[model samples]
Target: MPVESIHGRGATRNATPTRFNLQERMAEGDWLDQVEALDGVSSRRTSVTIEKPKSILTRNSSPDIGFDRSINAYRGCEHGCIYCFARPTHAYHDLSPGVDFESRLFVKPDAAKLLHSALSRPGYECAPIAMGTNTDPYQPIEETWQVTRSVIEVLLETRHPFTITTKSNRVLRELDLLVPAAKLGIASVAISVTSLDPKISRTMEPRAPSGRKRIEAIRLLNEAGVPCHVAIAPVVPQITDHELEHIVEAAVEAKAAGAFYLPVRLPHEVAPLFRAWLDEHFPDRAAKVMATIQSLRGGRDNDPNFFSRMRGQGPWADLLRTRFEKAVKRYGLRQTRFPLRRDLFTPPEGAQMRLF
Candidate 1:
């Protein structure tokens, strides 16, 4: 049977088995099967499950990534972006990395409390905490859950430095908290705009804010004295690659502090899911798109090396870098990194005192 694209959803199907081989297949009467049956008839409604984790802060020592620690208030994004690199994480829960990764969501209600506890530890070091690294902190469900907002509240109370990366304009809703934090040189935001065209954005990102809205968000954030940058992440080869110059120009017009981009990456189960998305939405150029991506990824679905993973190696990668550098220079947009201050960090009240 041909994989039918679900309405208002990015994944064409949800039965893509996880890479862990935890289960052979879905049971006959599983709710996922019911979802598959209602594909064309009705849209799949988003379902949120509350999660209480012991610790809210995640520490990573990857040399490529700038941040040393991060926090994810939610797992499994609802934005439904087909190229999301975080999709494979759903496999840990025995969930599909496809539609289930988007519709069946998880929110950490105790994130703020746990974060407060972590910051109060005597050995805790001050560093920028990155939000929306694994899942968007501002995904639609945030309106009700307010978990991300709660997490921010803790960060603000402790006077800790942090950064947020999201594609939704909803980050504007937190300007009340962000403004004061920015004044302290402890808060910054990066808005990801994958494509400028509404049609492409609708099918590609599905639930993310429109490109125009995101651009406006950049303007608003900068005007509010909060530093904002534009991120053209996962720039699709044949589909959205043509908009690189235009996107940079838009970022300049919006007064973005800086802009950066990365090529689409397909690792683990994401490879098959992305391929299915390409066939459903861009069948004509699917093969060409994969070909270009392989060339950028060194003839593989993905490059897992440290530096090379972040910065592709082949000629195509070089060309992308060259074009991006020229565009930033021509548009007069600074590509310089924005440094967040750690000196201003103050541990939460009741924190254990350190003795030299």
Candidate 2:
């Protein structure tokens, strides 16, 4: 079957008022002042459509990122985190990076096969393959598609090294595979926990596993002997920044081996999307939030300049770094600078190892 068939093709649109507009998936209706009027349409659950990806592995060579290559089992994420940097990726598929990014999802059933072929090639190099860097591999559709599981299966079978980053506790479902990989020093997991507040998490990352659940997942993974860490990432300045220490303390309590933190980044189309979300959710504090963000981002929406982008510049950035350092020191969180061994990698049958 063609890749398009494996990933569900675009649906034929019908002029039905009840049907959701997939193209504008994130557009929220007017705040309904009355409750009774929402009864007719509020109960309907949207049907998921699958889309097959032609290939899975995506490569990048940047000084800041640790991994050189990564794979995403799905195109758009259903997690619908308003602060997701990967949100803008949906625009490439002719969808809005906002609502369409969260609702009009795509799954690549062929991910395992494509990864196998890629790794089976003569030119293939052994590097930690990062998942969930762009989209959550274990999002809701994972229950049905199982593409992430299959991909992990391929990695485990070949004794391949990989790392996963995700916001879902669903990754616990694959501990059977990951635990073994960890034993071989071929795998590690990072759970992205944005905040401990349930109310904040509900609006910020609507469809992702709750923050508490993710912390529980970290504890579970660590108990199972899979190296796990908490990624206190994309720290929204005035919003979730205050919770940094709280997040680290919780992660350490949950037995996370180490912790890392990064400031909120709004590159490309993510800038506008983030602004819109801030406007919608925290209208009262939107300006203050953006102002704080600009304080770190060199007085702009984002800093796209290499080293500066990841860490940011100026006093606010320095303050955050200092705060993070102090928190990690107090919490005794482990360091993720744990390097994976690449010498054990062997080329697939009949393929020569890459010289590079």
Error of 1 at 214 (Å): 0.2
Model 1 per-residue lDDT tens digits across residues 215-237: 99999999999999999897888
TM-score of 2: 0.85
Candidate 2: C-alpha RMSD to true structure equals 7.9
lDDT of each: 0.87, 0.78
Off-target runs (Cα >4 Å) in candidate 1 are: 1-5, 25-40, 351-356
Q: Stretches of candidate 2 above 4 Å error?
A: 1-54, 348-356
Please, what is the TM-score per model? 0.93, 0.85
Model 2 pairs whose backbones collide? 7-51, 7-52, 8-50, 8-51, 26-99, 258-334
Which candidate leads in lDDT?
1
Q: How large is the C-alpha RMSD of every model relative to the true structure? A: 3.6, 7.9
Lowest summed-lDDT stretch of 10 residues in model 1?
A: 347-356
lDDT of 1: 0.87
